[model samples]
Target: MRYHRLTPAAAVLAVLTLSATACSTKSGTGTDTAGSDGVKTGPGVTETTITLGALTDLTGPYASLGRSIVNAQQLYADQLNASGGVCGRTVRITVKDHGYDVQKAVTAFTETEPNVAALSQVVGSPVVSSLQQEIEAKHLLTLPMAWASSLLGNEYLQVIGSTYDIDMVNGVEFVVRKAKLKPGDKIGHVYFEGEFGENALAGAKYAAKQHRLSIVEQKIKPTDQDLTAQVTALKQAGVKAVLISAGPKQTAALVGTAAAQGFAVPVLSNSPGFAPQLLATPVAPAVEKQLHVVSPAPSFSSDIPAIQKLAKDYKAKYPKALLDSGVIGGWNAIAVLGEDLKAACKAKDLTRDGIAAAHRKQSGLSILGVSHDFSDRAKPSTYESFVHKPSKQAAGGLVNVEPAHAVPAARSYPLPKS
Candidate 1:
């Protein structure tokens, strides 16, 4: 859902029909059986291979990120399979594109659920929200690419990094310090109207209250790409800085319009709000000069040993693909899942519930130099985040501007339960 994408009514009907066909013809037996190692195997977990599902947006608003994420996981699976995959079984991913539509995402999930042991990637906040109940009911371990706080508290849906609220709280603190915003100073927040934006806004509001700053709120829809009017309003409000919890297109629009209107100010955004390719656009100048992003993972060009290796392998495999931050996010989620599967294997139980249990037992996990704590299902994997700014010469067009750490404000802010 990247919140949501607009689709023609006809396309929705067509996808629904296609989903029905997939449901009838593509459904796997999903039967449980005993493995040679005496492991209890379930659907998608066979004697020779374990299949995972990826419900991603390949041709929608978040298509660029979706493709990047999918490709990285594919590369990881390839390497894992080559090196003897989890529990001596090869890993396979069955991917389905939902085009970022809620109904289509539901349809895709229903079609794909029967054939997979776990969901390796569900790419949108709203899409994951739509599937949470079924994920829990089935005891299916799922990794959501989205970081919405609302998606937390679900044991089945293991969010990979800092939740939207935590990232935003840290992001707000970064901006406040960089922009020298004193108490009573105002900042504008432009966000989509959904779980993703609202959750990030929660962090912003909390931080604002804590710092004695004021917030100018502008709520928009995912389909609303042009943010000229919103930019005008923030400028008129005379805000010191702007925080964005929307998509890349909206980010470009807001920053570009702000530049065109001469409303120069620091603009900070949630991770998904920026894409590397935007640096090639007319807004590149403004994006580079004014926009900063808070990411849950390392940049593609990061010099961290694991990240450098991933970058090398990813570039070798996908020579034509843009170096994207989603690759890191994708790899992180899959690596964590792989660890859980390994734990399940050691326990001689590869059932869906077994994998879920193994996930709950994981703590102090590290990937790409970020430590994750999954011991608490009610909390995010980590509060640490990397601050990034546009860099034309950097891979993914971004470079880390600050070290990864949870700011004091974020550490003290209470996470919203809703």
Candidate 2:
């Protein structure tokens, strides 16, 4: 759904209406109450239902990912509800399209904060950063879609898997091992200019230092689509391999432009840098040949039973939907929330504090065979990551080159101080 630019009055009115309809509750300071079941109830919890809010980007830079994420979450919630949801209450998701805008995200949060148990999904680093203070002030447990390392150390924010820095560290390690680079070798890193890119660059820098390699940097904005100049500069630098901390468009442009220019070298990227739809583009051959993405989730083509079931169920639900890692990400995030809710239910405390405490106690949470430990808020759930390369025949247009694992360097890399 396309969202046109709205006038201030219209935007406020729209958000109010959207929040009221989506929440189906009166707005006020969200508080908890005792339910008949002896469970502590909260603003988004009632006798029969529990609601979660999602601030996603459906008409912006990450729309492709946002759509799939929402679809998978809704699918998971529907299935859970059908099977009798946690603590005898049904699960509901109320989503707002922020279009990756900071103000829109803050507005959505303001309008919806009083009506949901927690935020199920908030896409983009900027959006997450913008809402951090509010989330902390309200003590709302939130799962962010982005993996910027800067989001770490927040008690209210649940970063799903390995952070951007760890992903880049693993990515650089993978590229180094694959390319057999020696000391003094140079690698080029093309990145964006914000939390995501800067954090990933830190990882790359750390990994390079560990391997005794030099880095050539090319920083760009998210709106910088065509990476011809970046590619050209990297190629001129005579780097042995290139790493990307940008989006799919920049990934495609870099790989395709490099191939066309005959700047043949391994290209590594963070997870969010690839999309299955790119397989249909003219850069398919180049992407398949050169691009490798480090992902927290397994590919849709993975043979894991749970993942296979998810792929089958997702296909059955949305026949025309493009298979991508976003679906798995969304499903995993909601599953994590489900775990927290179940714990809260078992403890007979369904308030925001209850949920947040429950999450801290959660450990060994598995999705796609990766164990997530929520005991540490200063670090990611895991340090391991799957390395994938594009393939036309793969269900998500990418297949794992190797099983997910954390390298020695990644294991020892320290997170940057906030």
Candidate 3:
């Protein structure tokens, strides 16, 4: 699942479908499998390489997100391969595009499934939701980039960040504290009708109840062009704040429309709303003054050294790709994959089952200073988010408005079901 927190990078896939032994001018000496140091081998493993699959949106609304993810996956694989890839096997990612269409995603996955050991990334919430039965039946190991909380409990889907619902709780609390909203103050929630929006609404409701705030809600369709009516309802509610659980375009529409109406309300948005083009929109001025976004990972401009190095390497590798926050999902997936690979290697069982078992053992693990720990996989992942304010002048263009905020309200929410 991709960019679900922010843009659809409006999601794209392919162009760098890594081959098992290809060497690039930029990345020297790619995959070549050596004997696994006495470890047991898995289905996708050959003597010199391990094949992985990716199903992402490449030619649809989320194509930009998918392309960024693809770039990051390629970059990580190159680095790993250069470093003598996981357990002496080079990582090769075979990607197929789903175009943000559920049926296409399912078809792509079905076709790709038999060729790989595990999935590298899968990017759409609706697609993932629709394929839950297949994912469970097949026991596919995936690092879902989608933000839906409903998928959190699946053992096979090692999520890249806190579920969308958890992020909303963190976001809601952040907004409440920053806005100084007291009990009885109303907050308006405008979201998509899909899982991403519904998950965000869950978190918002949890947090609102905890803080004694009233929630006024409106649901929108994915193809809805006009949010004028939605904004009107929120404005009429005399809401103290607005929570947007839609993608970048919807975020812009909500903020722009509300600002034009002179509602002057603080708007807190879920992760998918973080699009660079927002700064270039007519709503840019309003976004700068009123919008705060919740993110799953640190900005590329993070002060943390590991994150800084990641940013440097990404820019050097994907010179033309935008410095998107979605890269964190790719990096995090690779990082966790590295861990599972390490554990599997150590256990002398480099199979899909071994990787899944290893993942179950992670605790207090984090990546690039933004992702929360995957410790205690038997329980849902920890809930934490970075609250960022938009400023065109800022590095990565998103300035942290709050310290790394953890969601206490997660305890009150139900574990989302498949």
Candidate 4:
């Protein structure tokens, strides 16, 4: 929790020049680190190597995501080590599979924490929830992939993008404001029963209340694949638009099932709901017509100079892999990690505490548009998001409808109970 202001020259590499505006920041500021070389100052760090950890799900329901996150983290580390790693120390990452289970995640964290400096990517919200206490107790500065708004105030927590709750709010705002929800109309929500689903529900509920629209809810188990009953009920309920908080398979299933059942309503889904592979499936046309996604950044095809450079690098390294949300997200997470790592190294504090300190000072330095409008580390979250309409013409089948921005009442939305 301690921080020191970086010198101007150091700030150029570590801190992006923030403009004239009020914003959220990492942590409090102080002076430069004054530690000698050859002394043990942080965990998983030594004169020659720095070890990192990742808790992932390689054989579980969300295995695709877990694989993508690890691949990207390793890609980043490989590139760095090849070019002479941070502070002249080579980087190494240890990956542990939790299979998306809470108990498994805890066990993996318990074993991996002792051998690593930080956890680069923790995949599931519920899993992160399970490890939250131990992470704080150990002060392991973790940059998690799951964007649950509920994890906000934790000492070592840093989200990759906006939370699921925020993304949900953005989706709702798009329907109510731009898509034009009407009076006497209702919005229906179907979600898996977990932190991801609950956070998304919280956002949908907030938006519906604020817009004076009637809302109905349905919760589902992750194992229950057939959504015929849920879709039928929503159709019977006469809901106008549906919000889904589930994965790619369920997303396609619900939309496909709804289409087959003649309930042709638009679906607005949470970020994780869609993947590039959906476009190649049998339900491609239905998906293009009925689905829309909320995301933290522009799609992988974004022409931004930084993304272009990254895409180029990825193509050179792994030619056969198709660029999906997971791939882009993996690269993005590590890009941010690489920046903070360099900053931590420059500050001469490569230990767990020093890394946390460096993250505390990250203000406005986005690693090539991966994150925008970031201000402070302590409040490492944003209420802004963008809506992408499913498009048959676009490569990923989703086109931007609204530029990423803040909802009018976003800040007023209440934080969920601890």
Error at 60, model 1, angstroms: 1.9
What shift in Å separates residue 393 of candidate 4 from its native position after superposition?
A: 5.7
- lDDT tens digits, residue span 1-418, model 2: 1111222333322322233223334444355688889999777888888889999887776776777788888888888989999899988888888988999998988878888888889998888888888889888999989888788898889899998899888888889888999999999999999898999999999999999999999999978878889888988888999999888888888998999999989999888788877788999998988889898878877888989999999889777677787888889999999989999999999888899999999988997677999999998899998999889998888887878899988889999754
- lDDT of candidates 1 onward, in order: 0.84, 0.84, 0.75, 0.71
Once superposed on the true structure, which residue ranges of model 1 sit more than 4 Å away at CA? 1-31
Number of the top TM-score candidate: 2
Instruction: Give the range of the ten consecutive residues with the poorest summed lDDT in model 3.
Output: 23-32
lDDT of 1: 0.84
RMSD of 4: 9.7
Give the Å shift of residue 355 in candidate 1: 0.8
How do all models score by TM-score? 0.92, 0.93, 0.91, 0.87
Runs of candidate 2 with Cα error greater than 4 angstroms are 1-29
- The RMSD of every model to the true structure, in order and in angstroms, is 4.7, 4.3, 5.2, 9.7
| Tens-digit lDDT string for candidate 4 (352-379) | 7777777767766666564443334434
**Who is ahead in TM-score, 1 or 2?**
2
Each model's backbone clash number: 0, 0, 29, 13
